[model samples]
Target: MRRTSARSRISRALAVATAVAAVAGLTAYQGVAAEPAARTLAAGSPEGYGAGTTGGAGGPTVTVTSADAFIDAAASDGPLQIQVNGTIQLDDMEKVTSNKTIVGTGTRGRITGGGLNVSKASNVIIQNLTFSGSDDDAINVQYSTRVWIDHNDISDAYDGACDVKRASDGVTVSWNHFHDQDKNALLGHSDDNGSEDRGKLHVSYHHNWFDATTQRNPRVRFGNPVHVYNNYYYNNSGYGVASTEEAGVLVEGNYFENVKDPYHLGEADSGPGSLVARNNQLVNSGSGQTGGSVSTPSYSYRLDPAANVKSIVTSGSGVGHV
Candidate 1:
């Protein structure tokens, strides 16, 4: 039993009507700081840092200055804290696998003319960096799992900014800034080829800010079952979030300052099935929608009542449990 928002409201009504329960908790999505985890992949490599074994147990606190040497010498174990005193070129293809952490030197330091391509990797973390004048995706994830991308600024990507593809699962993107891209700042794919079908795929986006000055393209492509939360989108020349086909989706707790919606649901297909939306603050945005599906928000808590709810639920509520 999946309970829709209507059922949740009805349950509240019934409880009020019969006085069976008092004050059903307001169903709201909280923000997960994901900040500490944002710093490094983990603490120490209790298991030792290597490419095969889950990379490092945590992130290494190592610091580097050059992008050329950092990519060549970086290991999957621990955080690779590199400071870019000057501009670095990323023309060489780099492979990040297992749980590796890559943090840029200064936010002002820029990575130009290279692609941070993720291929067949898992548990990868990249943040606090900037990419400009990249011919391809500044960041790309393929056949990966458990990826966390936050707090980076990307722009002027001739192709796209970020792309998630090839049956990737358990991805969380938050607190990033985007500008001047040809496609979504965040994109997902259930299957890269037509042969593979969607069996299990889950992704989440939170607390991102987007500003598009040109009419290049939109900000998000929702290709899989995704959860979009608490983001601030503005000056988008295109859609905020859209889907190529039907997907299980949830859009909630977002603050849209100025946007244009080609579809009310931000999708080309009728829309995704089992879609849930609530508490989304939209201002000066279009309300065009498409598709057919059941979408609502804040109903999971109402369907099954539980005690000590905090343990079972974790979000951006000043706590970090991912």
Candidate 2:
């Protein structure tokens, strides 16, 4: 394991102090009471199935400003915190190994012309970054466990913005802004891979801003007890969530504005799955199709009010907000 440098520790401490003071000042100036401590897990923090996910928490922190440095730090062994400081350009998807925290510096961190691949890795966190113009999916997690993807701006990817497939379990996707793209998020890869996918792919999708995205506000397959809650869907041209290939999905407490299809039980070529839709607010949206029985989540979480989901998601999602 790498050791934290004195300069990095001091910088991190000052940053934390600055953020605390800013938050306090804002609350005092607005005359609004602070949110409950439990609400801290609502956006940036990992919860639900990924509650145990800790990425490079006790590892050394290294700042990377170029593609070469970023790639080197990501592929290094053991626990590590890789801070992206500026736009790092690449030609294709790059690998991120196990036990890594790849976070952006303020709002200036970005990855363009490429994306990240977390293949066969575990305990990874990717947060507070802007990703655009990727040659492939903005973030691809396959055969990975305990991964958290939060508070990022993802758009214009060649494929899905975030795709978790091939038995990726204990995953959480939260507080991300997905816009101007098709195939926004996917939870499974193929319909015939149930041998490897069955009884796995447990994921939590919450507080994500699906803004004008076309389809696959996570099209899921063979993932039982997949929880989708408190998400905001606005002006989506295609649809919201799709549960197919015998998957079980619980969709609840979401706000859908001007979306034709908020969620459904099946999709093209794939057999119908099980879905339970509850407490979702649909404004000018079609009533979604549903069938079969879905399982309840084992973890505990606080749900934001459906009526306030739009405001909460838009204000807190994307880079620099966390």
Candidate 3:
């Protein structure tokens, strides 16, 4: 299906709302329908955006406490503030529009049972939410730009906990926790769909806690120059980072504990990507395979020692009080 523009979608939604109000002889509802939300958010900065990206600015704040309300708010156009005050369990994927800030109010505000899909959206921020038992990916970013997924607890998904593909760029996935899950994260899905994902899928993953995930801490495919740093991996039953499809992955400053296979350039050297591993600390883990070099990250961020990564991540990563 052809993607509809956010403005056009909003216009249609407002028109429907107005028509409904008119049919009900409630004209006053039109005056206060889907107004611009007001929000103060730091812009997203990745891939040449110096200070990061901005999202859903100058809009009204909508506090959603149920699945239907959350879906309604997410369907609306951006510059929107969506505050989740409690759990919103869904039966399907919720499409999030452009320029949106979806944050949890506290530790208990979470999205469970279903998931969120951000496709063809720009300037989105998702933070401080716990997602589990989702029928699909906990959070999927496809063909999106300037997205930040931070401080969320994602696990037990039917698919990947967090998956980024389909030419998504300018993204940062940081400070999250993944435990007791398989197919933890995937940068690119299909090896044949390289036209849309070959030069894109630029993402920075840092300070995430991968605990007991069976595999694919992040299975990379055709995502060149993926910056993965300062993450804590513990008791991983499967390999940590697999760089396949000629992707250049810079895996650095991470702590791997009791992980059999930490990092590899490709699956048994079958693919063509390269990996650069340096200054990392490993305990009871296989030495990661490294061959190729990747480009450095765009912005400068503080990274603690590999020895301190486990402690810092265990103490700070995941939902609640982030």
lDDT of 3 at 203: 84
Q: Each model's TM-score? A: 0.65, 0.87, 0.85
- Candidate 2 per-residue lDDT, tens place, 150-198, comes to 9999999998899999999999999999998999899988999999999
Please name the candidate that would achieve the greatest TM-score relative to the true structure: 2
Which candidate model has the greater TM-score, 1 or 3? 3
Quote model 3's TM-score. Answer: 0.85
Candidate 1 lDDT over residue span 86-165, tens digit each:
46677744667565666555444467887677677775666667778887778777777767666677788777777766
User: Comparing candidate 2 with candidate 3, which one achieves the higher TM-score?
Assistant: 2
- The global C-alpha lDDT for each of the candidates, from Candidate 1 onward, is 0.50, 0.84, 0.78
Each prediction's RMSD over C-alphas, in Å, is 18.2, 8.3, 6.0
Residue 63's C-alpha lDDT in candidate 1?
A: 38
lDDT of 3 by residue, 159-268 (tens): 98999988898888888899969989998868777888888888888889999998888888887788888999999987899888978888889999999899986664
Error of 3 at 269 (Å): 10
